[model samples]
Target chain A: MQNVTKSKWWQTMILKTIAMVLIGFIVFGPLMGTLLWSFAEKWFWPAAFPQELGLKYWKIAFTGQSPVLDSMAISITIALIVVVLATLISVPAGYALARFNLPWKRILLVLFLMPQAFPQLPVFINMTSIFYRYDLVGTVPGVIAVHLVISLVYSVWITTAAFKSIPVTLEEAARNLGASRLRVFFRITLPLATPGLIASSIFVFITSFDEFTGTFFIGAPFIQTLPTLMYTASMGYNMQYASVIAILLTIPALLFMLVLEKFLKAEYISGLGV
Target chain B: MQPRAAVKRPSIRVSDGQREAVSGLVLVLPALLVLCVLYIYPLCASIAGSFVSDEGIGLHNFAKAFTLYGTDILFTIGITIITLVLVFVVAVLTASFLRFRNWPFLNFVYRLPLFIPYLIAGHTMRVFLAPHGILNILISRVTGLSDLPGLAFSWIGLVITFVWKQFPLATLLILGAFQSVEDSYIEASLNLGGNKVRAVWEILLPICRPTVLVAMVLTFVSTIGCLTIPLLIGPSKPVMLPIDMAFRINYMGDWGVANALGVISYLIVIALSMYYLSYTVKKEDA
Candidate 1:
């Protein structure tokens, strides 16, 4: 009888190589198209690769000719504000939940985690009307509010996990040495949790930076971010401009997340886009 | 200071328990306040607004939504289901590869799209999947065949884009679970004369089933909620719910129908999650 259970070594090698090539294409193929287009000044069908490659579109983007620079600045500004605000709000709460016997603590955890369960687009749809009442629609404040809500999923959870990972005994030991509670926290706890805190802040910044549905609903037609700008550029089939913006929007996120993948918990990393 | 004086002074120094309680409350309130004001308030408003309409507070808006965009709702569900299945398949294969293999280039490439945002993902897919786009050109050149109808601006485009975009996150989650599972399990199966495929199928996958399910559910939920993918590459005749909901609001200025549709999507997520939660809880209890 022929052995059907095992493949030959060469067959396995071939299969593995094929799988890798397929995976590589599936992963990098679209991005390559975008990258090529970003440089392509004139490229038509029947030819593989760009007909002409130049920095013409890139110069337009970099020289503040298009709204790309403004949009990029605005996106960074909003992401920074949201990251700081989210960090400020999440730190104490995360520490409290991790260390204290707060009332309805379970409910609070569930509430913080609620964004994972809820579909966000609808809430944003309704938010437009609600924020409109307060003159927040199409304003930076309104957009920031939306980003803050989404940021909570990562900020609160990661912050809580960060604090929780530090042993309470360490804090208690410091406390027994005649150290004040605030002093113990500042010195003992915060230092230990810095890695997680930094990761959490980066996560918030990434979320707020890439945020589209919320920003689109609450801030479009007035506020323009890299994502919103990319959307318009793509809509017009301005492939060169869109591709340039796409590359801009992508690089920081990839770089930060590569660093982030080391410090953040697997669970928190998975929580992204949830 | 006498005890009576302390009581009369209303506690110049509060009790430890009381102090802790206040501290906990103070520390916890700001995050909760943000959640309440930004998330909870608008969510409630969406639900509440769906009810009040021209006629009265009822399912009138729901009935209207179903009548107008019922096909789009179904289309959304169909795309979600198709995307979930494809995403699940891609996630499992890629995650298993990452776990079982030590290919450095594979590792680096797999993670490239993981952090790319949705809108950017949409545009890239829009171009790459276009009729005479790069993918099509490559296929024709390789196979020596022409007349390849492309996937862009159709259901397949949406599926490919969703799977491609979601692949990294889903694989990361599944791969994380796979990593936690000890090598001994797979080694045990292999020692018993089981093949690598069998070892992975029987040992590794079963151990990581819960994470797989959660990953699937998350992908499903987000796929339904996705507006960017469909808007960028959706078919004109039957669209997804988000696009439909957007049209109702942007074009028609119909908030009632939008909220109704929103509630419907919300209910779908809640029902699935509740089932998952109950299943996990019941398993833990057992």
Candidate 2:
């Protein structure tokens, strides 16, 4: 009996360890591969590791000689613009939806969900023709407008939930205490909702940064972002350069995720549940 | 405090209600304008473009699209289904473990992939799964399995990349569901002489059905419309729908066929969206 129990304990331990190791490899193995390749000068077949390592690719990506630095700058600029615009647009709309018993509220909710739920290819294709006619193709603002279509949905949905989560009584109490409406909003509501707002902004920034197909359709030929640059380089057989850019693009997203980790529970419940 | 004063206050109350309504409309106007111009108009124009060609108002372009790229449509559906199944299995297992187990490192590992962009994830997989890539190198060294099957630019590679990129989201969502499930139900099942597997299958899964369904539908919709994974790691022959539509426009300048394909993809997503919307509505009502 004792031997059987001991063997059972060993079996469970071994199974748990196996699961942990496999999950670790599946999640981190490819990441490690990209990291090595970014610095590798001569990695080839039948070798367990790279034969040589250098920062040539990294240097090229950082220097202005390559398109990478410019593309990175373009991506950041576009994402920042998207963050500001999405926040500005979503806050009021989210507030109305959360606080008011408006007509067609359900229809409005569905309308907000449509951009995210529908296929983007059709929209991108259609926008290409309109953009061409309006002379908006190959322009930064054009690309930003298209990205807004997607990011706005996330911001509105998230901020709506954010507003909904704030207790209504707090605002009423402030009003009863003779606080002006604007003062009540600025002093009571906004501060309490800051975490959700920040989370939504981070989400908007990431979505805009990673947007590709729409950007490719609208911003090609004249404007280039990091994603489009990576696509072109990889297609053109420049994997080393692509790897460096990939790492550079990943840094901001990872940092946001780390910042978001503490707010994960709140964000998940109010921001992402819908 | 008298009747005349009450009458005056009622008139003011009516005006206040009207003002509130007007302000609410004003608040939502910008979002509404963007949706119309950027989303609704473009989608309508694309669908209309598909039906109206030189012949004027017909399914002729759709027929042309089908005859030209039927295999691509089928391939996209197949890939979506496969990725959906794999994601479901992986997410369920991982979510269960994370919810029930006490391993902090495992939790961190599961969240690692959530930060990665799809394009970067594709590149990472390409580097690792290439013909002479790190994975093959490691396998050859350890198991004497040289010249193992290459995965880059293959359907298998695309599936692996999609699963890796998407399953973390599924796990996060499903784990949210799992955390809400009561431990007492599983305990009751155990006390009733059921095994752990049976307890999970009978008690927990049934309760989490709606959430799991939502997660699966989301995975299906997103995977079907995906471009980067299929474009980066997928094969050149039987391409995915997004890639096919993109090439038709970018390479051939065939707007008619591209718009037709676009309509087809849109219809599929719309159908799925309707189902999801209904589910949410039903849940709300319940």
Candidate 3:
């Protein structure tokens, strides 16, 4: 028994060690290269690695010379705006989805779900025409409005799951005792679903913030975002500058993801189960 | 009954009866309006743009599409399929491995790819796979190879970049599904003389089947709409659909042709989504 247990423990330890190494390499390989390239004076052809390193690229990225800082701020602000608006709209809709049995609910659900799969490029192109007509393309609100389509769908899906978890009996009992519907909803349902609401809102923010194609196709040149700026720097052969912006832009997202992993128990839509 | 009689009864409906319905509508109106303006309107406009021509209610745009060398469209469809399959396969394997081992660090590693946005992934791949990038330099130093050929602007490079970008998402979804499998089933399979592979194929696979399907569908949908990977790493020959569509709008200023292609792509997306939804509903019913 001792011998078998020892072998099993040894095997488990070996496997775990291997997994850790692979994981580290997988994550840090490109990241390390990116960091090295960012600090390097020049990443030229035929050089094995950077021989010289300095803060020159970082200085450029931070200064008013590059639009990296401004674009990052715009991207985050837009994402937050979308998150707030999407959560506000989706909470009530999610309530209707979960609690009510309205006809055409299936249709509504499908409509919400379809956008996730739909190709966003064409929609952007066509919307550009409409934006051209209405003069909403160049501004931040125009981009935010377009982003809300995707953000709202995701928000509704997640928040509906959150709202569904509140038991009907609690609300019914409150109503039976002369408590108002608004009172029950605001006091009971909203509080119970707070965690889900928060999780979904963060997801909305992440999606909107990370959005590249729509920001490129519709809000490009005039309203630059971080991803678009990264694309431009890389395309313009400013590898060092691109890497700096890339690392800088990626930090907040990485931090948010880590925090989320701690609280958002990785069940696909866990809040939906009542 | 006696308790009920002792208490005063209250009215169920509020004084602002009609206003409640209006409030609900008011709450939903903005989102619905945006959806109509953005999604529904663009979709309609694209279709209208497709049909507009001097030829009088004819299929001119589609005729143009048919004649305009559909190799790009075909190439894109092929790439989408291959990327989905490869990503799904690799993801399932890695996820299964993680599940079997229950490795903590593996979870973090598997999710790291999600942090890099698609554009960054494309750019990173370009840098790493450039002619004088680490890939070629390593090859030269290790094997004394003079040239590490076909690193950039190649089909193989495009596939590699896409797989790298997409695999992490697939792995996460599959890993989450893998976690849901009970340990008892594995023990049961083992006791029945089944090895890990057999156990995974029979027990674990069936349990996580729905999740795998979801992952596959998402990856397919994502690849179909992608433009960056192909533009970055793909060869000049056999142009991909998204790039082609963009070219039509930008270079040619042919909104009609561009919108026609968009409409076609949208129709395919709708079909795929409907199929996925119907399957899900049926699965639930079953």
* iRMSD, all candidates: 5.3, 3.8, 4.0
Chain B alone vs. reference chain B, TM-score for every model: 0.87, 0.86, 0.84
List, residue by residue over B46-100, the lDDT tens digit for candidate 3. Answer: 8888887657565888788767947777777788778877997889888888888
Q: Give the CAPRI rating of model 1.
A: acceptable
TM-scores for all candidates: the values are 0.90, 0.92, 0.88
**Model 3 regions lying over 4 Å from their true place:** A1-20, A266-268, A271-274, B1-29, B54-56, B267-286
Clashing pairs for predicted structure model 2, backbone only: none
- What residue pairs are clashing in model 1? none
Chain B TM-score against the true chain B, candidate 3: 0.84
**Candidate 2 lDDT, B135-189, residue by residue in tens:** 8888888899877887988999999998999898888888887888889987898
Candidate 1 ranges beyond 4 A from true positions: A1-17, A265-274, B1-22, B192-202, B274-286
Q: Which residue pairs clash in candidate 3?
A: A161-A271, A161-A272
DockQ in order:
0.48, 0.56, 0.44
Instruction: Summarize candidate 3's per-residue lDDT along A109-171 as a digit string, tens digits.
Output: 667766676777777788888887788877898889878886777787777777777677777
Instruction: Please give the fraction of native interface contacts (Cα pairs under 8 Å between A and B) kept by each candidate.
Output: 0.69, 0.65, 0.46
lDDT of 2: 0.83
After superposition, candidate 2 runs with Cα above 4 Å error = A1-14, A267-272, B1-19, B270-286
User: What is candidate 1's CA lDDT for residue A205?
Assistant: 94
Which candidate achieves the best TM-score against the true structure?
Answer: 2
The lDDT of model 3 is: 0.76
Candidate 1 residue B27 Cα shift, in angstroms, is 0.8
